[model samples]
Target: VLSFGLAGAASQLLGDMAHRLIPVTDREAASLVRSIRTAPLLFGWRGSTPVDTPALEELLLRVSRLVDDHPEVVAVTLEPVVVAPHGVSVLGA
Candidate 1:
């Protein structure tokens, strides 16, 4: 699953979640990242520096690989991930 929302929004908020089988592909993961409703924020909305969206996409792929490698891992969540111009910070797992 790929899930996210505006910085302070709730988990179950509408349009903030997606699901897929294990071993999620690059294309699939990219789609999920693009589906973010607040994606404009990642692209330098209002003159702010754009977050490194490609880096965020890489993180999603890594999470997919983790689950594919470990069947025991049913879910993964990263909360309050601060996306910066150059990278992202996973504040909570």
Candidate 2:
């Protein structure tokens, strides 16, 4: 379950992102993706295939649960999360 502590606007240039506190729900996870300006890339841009949004949502939810289960975890950052039609891969965490 890879995730991050709030999405950034990608060097503050690409676009904006949505955020919520820990314990995010599935609905919120979906909304987070939608709120991102570059969300279309995830849905399939150009001739690219769309990634599994449900898997992304599940990963977000699981990360939220981890935060809720632990008290010492103050921040988490998983950069370059590669998502494809087949699966997702965390490039760095």
Candidate 3:
């Protein structure tokens, strides 16, 4: 699942969301990332700077791998993730 909203927005109020089955392929991850309504923000809306979206896809892939490899793990939550021009950062996990 992927969702975006104003910073510090509640999970339920994210407004835009996308979801796909786990153990996602690279293609699926990329599709999932782009499927979000706010995806244009990552691709440089208007004259704004674009963020490292491929890095976000990679992060999703890594999270998928973690879940696929660890059956005991039920869920993962990464909050306040910062997506910058060069990379993505997880402020909380």
Candidate 4:
């Protein structure tokens, strides 16, 4: 199984995040979404459309698996993963 942890926009000043050791389940992924202080952004705040959180969770899970499968990958970084109502895009990595 994949060994994973928190994967998202986690900053003390901006927002908070949830984390787990590895093999995070669907329930855990949902919980992680709730743990974020800026979670409202994901669920749609004001006139903004809600983001595809499921996609984000899937991405996280996939990344975790990739890391687990590749021991040579000591570290990974995916910055500015843009999420929208329809889909998500990786602006940088």
TM-score of each: 0.80, 0.80, 0.86, 0.77
Alpha carbon lDDT of each predicted model: 0.74, 0.72, 0.78, 0.68
Residue 82 accuracy (lDDT) in model 4: 80
The candidate scoring highest on lDDT is 3
- List ranges where model 1 is wrong by over 4 Å: 10-15
Which digits, one per residue and each the tens of the lDDT, describe model 2 over residues 1-93? 323332455725653656877778788888887776677777887978888888878778877888789968877776767767877777887
Pick the winner on TM-score between candidates 1 and 3: 3
Highest-TM-score candidate: 3
Every model's Cα RMSD, please?
A: 2.2, 3.6, 2.6, 3.8
What lDDT tens digits, residue by residue, belong to model 3 across residues 29-55?
A: 888878876778778899899999889
Prediction 1 TM-score vs. true? 0.80
What lDDT tens digits, residue by residue, belong to model 1 across residues 1-93?
Answer: 545455545535554655666577888777776676666777888998888888887888898888878889987878768878888889998
| Residue 36 miss distance in model 1 (angstroms) | 2.0
Model 2, runs deviating above 4 Å = 1-11
Clashes of 4: 1
